[model samples]
Target chain A: MLEELTIQQKIKYLQDTLYVISGKWKLLILMSMYGGTCRFRELQRSVEGITTRVLSKELKELEVNKLIERKIDNTYPVLITYQLTPYSFSLKPMVDEMITWGAQHRKELSKP
Target chain B: MLEELTIQQKIKYLQDTLYVISGKWKLLILMSMYGGTCRFRELQRSVEGITTRVLSKELKELEVNKLIERKIDNTYPVLITYQLTPYSFSLKPMVDEMITWGAQHRKELSKP
Candidate 1:
């Protein structure tokens, strides 16, 4: 049997998962991937405000976590694209809820 | 009118929201509250092994974020309890999804 984590260890494990997806642009990248697989430049355009550096970093982190898969296409010059893994797609509902919640909260903020 | 945040600003704003809820124990606290308003001791028990210090700190932070409300019951001695605010309750679906997702992912982890 796999060892059971202590409460502290379980909490730490949860925290680590949060940390992996904790960046500003990570969810936006996630949201973007919902449309289709995206080339590096396509993601930049889709998210529309992330800098190259932060996007690169967030993509690398997601890739490392196995939430995203990067595929290289060698048709002439190499083209690279990112797509959500099945694991990553599992988070779609959470991300959508966040977006919906954000919209509602934003509406409230506009109240006098 | 509040100025529209730049793309960089928008990303940062989204990230800040994530950071506020990103703690390991935060969702568990939210989950426990679903049962009912939780006395401090009750929360400690429901969560099953969070340090008193960390619980106190997390409670304070949740209060600061306006996601939870703390009430002091003055029945002879003082009793403190935490309850989810409407805003916090709005997160119920998201939290539920996380728990469900975690369970599914855990099952996958156990597969050879």
Candidate 2:
């Protein structure tokens, strides 16, 4: 499929994808939520090194992109949680490939 | 494989990959080389909108990462060309997945 794309189209497609997922924290935040729905504090804890403010912004962006859903439970003490949407699964192949490549890269770099 | 990883390890792996490929221009420069080896001027032209200075920097970084080789032919006019290293092909699976997801993302965003 990539072979079928002209260079211009390929670049545009790559740009679109990167715009949604390229960031220090977006993918990490999403990875954290993969286990189950997570409240804001839980997410902050799970995605270590993420500040509360940064996590809030990343979650909002993910929600706007439809990659995640923010659910609110209106109890005596309101509870809000974030979870991956079905659409987020679209990233699984790419993410898997990245992990495979990354692990290999680490090994390659460690060669004596 | 990803499921087996603790969250910390997963995040580290992801970060390792992103450090190499996450950027506005690195992948674009790489995509241009997929056709074949190219001289600096040719690459700058093919990767539209890239300045000579930026392209030079990107090429040097790619060489440092061992993703590309910069060969200088000490002929009459010094024929310098950049080509992808075998290690770079390891990125093919990830790049293909990105292109696939990227095209789908463009379509998704165009919904009425």
Candidate 3:
């Protein structure tokens, strides 16, 4: 159980995970790339209101963590595709649970 | 897949979960209570570096979300015990995954 864990262990666990997805952008980026590969511009467009600088930074972090893969495609104009790695799918259950909880939260908020 | 969710849907999902555990303290608080009931001072001591003000705020939020239960014990002085609800255990897998990933991250950082 988590109670018996030392503060040092808990803090390290907290830091690493928060360090990876601390900001608002990373999870959004992950959601955008969940279905299939997305090009840079497509991802930028998908997340809505995320600036290129922030998106670029989140993408790099996800890539470094191996949650996503970035590939270069030499089409007419060339494209950089971002897709989820098998490792990232580990997040599926958590995200799905969030979606369920989020819907319920919205419902609760709307009650008069 | 999460990819297929519309931005509106994704945002709602993201906001709901983040709303629940957005900060450093919430998860740690959850971790501290994972094993069994804990008193107010015990949680504050377990988390380390958190102030009384922040602790109260986080405790209220967690209670509102139904992730934790609060009960008052009228002893000589009075004590409040915090315990995780079944709903909170839904987060067990995600926290465990974070702990695993965090350890790997620390190991990677320590590698020469």
Q: Which candidate is the best by TM-score?
A: 2
Error of 2 at B16 (Å): 0.8
Off by over 4 Å in 1: A1-20, A35-57, A74-79, A108-112, B1-20, B39-57, B74-78, B108-112
| Top candidate, metric DockQ | 2
Cα TM-score per model: 0.63, 0.90, 0.70
Query: What C-alpha lDDT does candidate 3 achieve relative to the native structure?
Result: 0.79
Q: How well does candidate 3 score on lDDT at residue B48?
A: 79
For candidate 3 chain B, the 10 contiguous residues with the lowest summed lDDT are B103-112
Name the better of 1 and 2 by lDDT. Answer: 2
Decide which is better by TM-score, 2 or 3.
2
| Tens digits of lDDT, candidate 2, A43-83 | 88888788988888888989888899999999969999889
When 1 and 3 are scored with lDDT, the better candidate is 3
Q: Tell me the alpha-carbon RMSD of every candidate.
A: 6.7, 1.9, 4.6
Which regions of candidate 2 fall more than 4 Å away from where they truly are?
B1-4
lDDT of 1 by residue, A1-112 (tens): 1135354444444455466566556777876787678999989988877899989999998887678899999887888989988888777676555555554555554666
Runs of candidate 3 exceeding 4 Å displacement = A1-15, A71-81, A100-112, B1-11, B73-78, B97-112
TM-score of chain A of 3: 0.80
Tens digit per residue, CA lDDT, model 3, A11-81: 68767777777767788888778679898889999888999988898899888888899999888888788
lDDT of 2 by residue, B19-80 (tens): 88877889999988989899998998888788989889888888877899999899998899
Worst 10 residues of 1 chain A by lDDT: A1-10
Q: TM-score of candidate 1 restricted to chain B?
A: 0.78
